[model samples]
Target: MKQALQLLVLIFSLTVFGQNGNTDTAQVVIPGRYNSVEAQAKPYVIMISADGFRYDYAKKYHAENLLKYSNEGTQAKAMLPSYPSITFPNHWSLITGLYPAHHGLIDNYFYDYKRKEPYAKSNKKNAEDGTWYGGLPLWGLAEKQGMLSASVMWVGSASDAGGARPTYYYPYHEKFSPEEKVNKVIDWLRLPMDRRPHFISLYFPEADANGHHFGPDSKETEEAVHKIDQAVGQLVQKVKELGLKNVNFVFVSDHGMIKADNENPLEIPQLLLDKNRFDIYNSQTLLRVYVKNPDEVKKVYKELKANKTGGYKIYLDKKFPGSLHFSTKDDRYSRIGQILLFPEAPRIFLEKGEKSTAGKHGYSPKTVPEMKATFYAWGSAFKRNITINEFENVNVYPLVAHILGLKINGPVDGKLKVLKETLK
Candidate 1:
């Protein structure tokens, strides 16, 4: 009877596993690239993203601790965010180290042609769906490599990427205060040594929302900035108090915020009549027009080009500027709009009447300083008192992988050499 019960348990587990409709059905094998290595004496990594924190925020608000952090560890003056430098795309880029295009998340709100479902932050079902998300997320990567990770309100952390999530992750929530977030991270760290996660991700978004409402340069924005800085300070103090060594902490942001040019805004819906003409997920800073009907691609292209009244430029999918790297080269992942409409920087588009918000991102990183992000890492793994110049955000993936000694089965857009200077 005991043997029969054990056999039944095994069968139950198998049945449950088989019922999970993971996008990648194959059993994951840790690839050769991520070879097993001598585990470090102390291996703890923390990644905190202050949503909408610009590279210059440290300077603008005189965030003393953050500035001192820059001085004490490796600091990148500005981390260039991926094109369409907005919230979700840039946040995912930091972890996966793949551009939004490569990751199959072209924009914050896009329609999944395959699933016939909409991908939006508010849609819990879509947010948790693995079919809409592609590539290996860092949390899932840690799970595969026998390490543990935790995320507190980080984008994509809640999602079922390839049917895997962090060992511990809470779905995105706005009610959690900055202090609560810091305390929760400490709680995770204080777990029994054997159970503690080796990696943790935390996110604070008050700054982003504040910036959107009051503009990046507003005094209201400063309040959010001050609050986030205080939270950072509190986080460091808690770690020091805990006396945990061999820990690495990385401070980053998805993208910066800029004042919107609401004075002379171009209304997209007014400019084009066909609202349902292709699932055009339009935003203030950018527009991603994914065609519902393949035949309409040509018609849409002609309509966009003739709209000389607008301040945006339209490009064929293949003709977008190479520097932006906003489209995928691989045929397997090529699902971006056949007709790309790129609005010039600072100036923005509106679905209806003028200014969408006081400020925004999702503009060309090249032209807008606000679109640039920040990267400052200080810990056991990073060398002290180093200041590096600007670099693209995609390289961050290899940096995290190198610190953890993780390997991937396939090529990642981020190269390890670019981040070699950052290691101790």
Candidate 2:
């Protein structure tokens, strides 16, 4: 009976995998790389990102494992996601230590006036193309310094950002179960010291998917949180069994979630719909408007300001609030639109007849507490029983680099001073 039940479970898992279609399960290896003598002697870090894991999800859902682990190590009140807290931008920011505007992935979807093309997260070619990315990610930074790295699935890992990819990596996909992912990490760590990755990244999308489909407060979202927590426990236990004393874990999330006002969704102003005047990219909480003629900026800005509703605010690119670091001065790639629209929480801009999801994000974290992400570190590298105040996500890059002894090649927004106290 036990064997029969096991077979039934295997069949069910295969059926679910088939539904997701054929995904590349093979690991992509870049040969002829080894950790430097100094790096091999340094500690290992396995940074995991659980997409859309809200700041309070663990405690709210009573995720026993995460709560215990964080209590034993370091926990933050909250991690502030960069402005326009969407997945692609925030993930890249976390990895590269640059603000979204500075890193050039200003939004998940936006038109690049210079390239005369649109960058959509759903476009495989655009996502994998290294030229679209800026700044050296953690993996690339490690590899450049003669240390090996790997990634299960990270935002920019698939792309050859910073002129190199992780020595071992898998392109973004959802076919791998949490157990499979943890096992993959174990396998990487089990390899010979010369070939094993010193810096590794793991990603999970369950919580985000559930939050968007069933709302942040739904039982489905809670279950997803619990699953992630359990996976963390499993990974930690497996590492302990391997007797890897130097391995450290840093768990984080790109952003949080909030229930949107789906029933009374905000409508796009008619002026934005005029193709002759503007090209628009809409992400519900934030809207980017590109003006065709430079001279028409003031005219359209004036008109939109008069027609603005209560749920959203419109701003000219040059006049964007400096605190958000999304203004013209901060746009390193000139990717930000001429005009912007920011929707308040619980209100999203949706077109007529288009359905809205129960949960949404992408608001400035300063304005909406719900947009704050999570940060929990529990490993030999971190201090124990320490809880720090809120800090921006950019600071995380330096903290990881410090632990692994990888030097930042250039100036990044993240400063080690902000998070150095968390470490021993």
Candidate 3:
């Protein structure tokens, strides 16, 4: 029995060290004025994503509660979302503090022509198998440090990530009532101090769903936002009720919705090409075209470059031109199609039979409103009554990693610069 126990211990250590041998220690570069220890020992951190909530919507629609939160907390001029700016990819980016390419989720849907399988947001097989997701989410980082973490409704939260999962999670399901969702978050906060999570994320999807069914400017959309705000109120009130005083709350969004264009469906006919030449899949605003041969790929690129395209702006994935700030490789979420078809000024991507009443946001991140989103933080650790200049989503991870004391393995695209000004 003693020999068996020793053997088990030996195997476990070897397995542990083997997997973490390459794990990089997180590095901290403190500013001259602030002490590292003080920054490291801050407080509880919570991030919330109100799906499809636009930067202007809150201000324009009289979302006073949210605006008050922003007014009192450290808010940004604008929160620039990542490219394609879809839900799943953007949410994944928020957690990993990585762009889609680095994180491996390019859009809500990806085509695997060889396997004849496509990855969509709700596809159970892809969600459960975990191949569709890449990188470590923020909660996973907190859990690793002996700190508890919880999430109410984050994309991929219920999915297995990096083999282990969140200490607390609730799967995304249509059957979940808004009240139930709010209560679940409140319930998690009610856990005893020893069991309380160091990090928590709450997600509300009503606004996005409503925007999709009814345009962003509609009454239905307004009602949805109000309802979500009430839920936010419930969450904030409960945190106080539970005396979770050492907490910071961040309110953000995936990407704002746009009214769908109904003029003409942006179409790419594979029938126009040699059937053996390309495999085409359309995901809303972008068309992913994968070709069989490199030579054929060149021919396609040339044709797209010289053509008087109808309503599509095309680019070769390997050499996605400047101004887009998007990586060319699809290795992470950055893997773009050989020819990406971005809808013209009045057009958006659509399948043969797809209809959308709500606007979409997969256009270039530079689109005036589409690029714009929200970021507001309030509570114990943040400086009160400060709104800083605009920053991109890439800057978000470092701030989060800093708060949670998690080390990022690679160089973060954005700096700890934003927090430098805000946290002080």
Per-residue C-alpha lDDT of model 2 across residues 1-424, encoded as one tens digit per residue: 2122212211201121222366677899998888888888989999999999999999999999999989999999999999888888999999999999999998877777788776767666778888899889999999999999999888878898899999999887767899899999999999998898999999988898888888999999999999998999999999999997788999999999999898788888998888777777777788788898999999999999998879889899999999889999999999988999988787988765566677888998998999999999988889999999999999999999999998898989999999999999
TM-score per model over all chains: 0.86, 0.94, 0.84
Error of 1 at 235 (Å): 0.8
- With a 3 Å backbone cut-off (N, CA, C), the pairs that clash in candidate 2 are none
- Which stretches of model 3 miss by more than 4 angstroms? 1-42, 112-117, 269-274, 322-325, 329-335
Ordered from best to worst TM-score, the candidate numbers read: 2, 1, 3
Q: Residue 59 CA error for candidate 1 (Å)?
A: 0.8
Query: What are the runs in model 1 whose C-alpha is more than 4 Å off?
Result: 1-42, 269-271, 275-277, 291-300, 328-335, 353-355
Q: Evaluated with lDDT, which candidate comes out highest? A: 2
Candidate 1 C-alpha error for residue 189, in Å: 1.3
TM accuracy, model 2: 0.94
lDDT of 3: 0.67
Give stretches of model 2 more than 4 Å off: 1-20
The TM-score, computed over Cα atoms with residue i paired to residue i, of candidate 3 is: 0.84
Give the top-scoring candidate (TM-score): 2
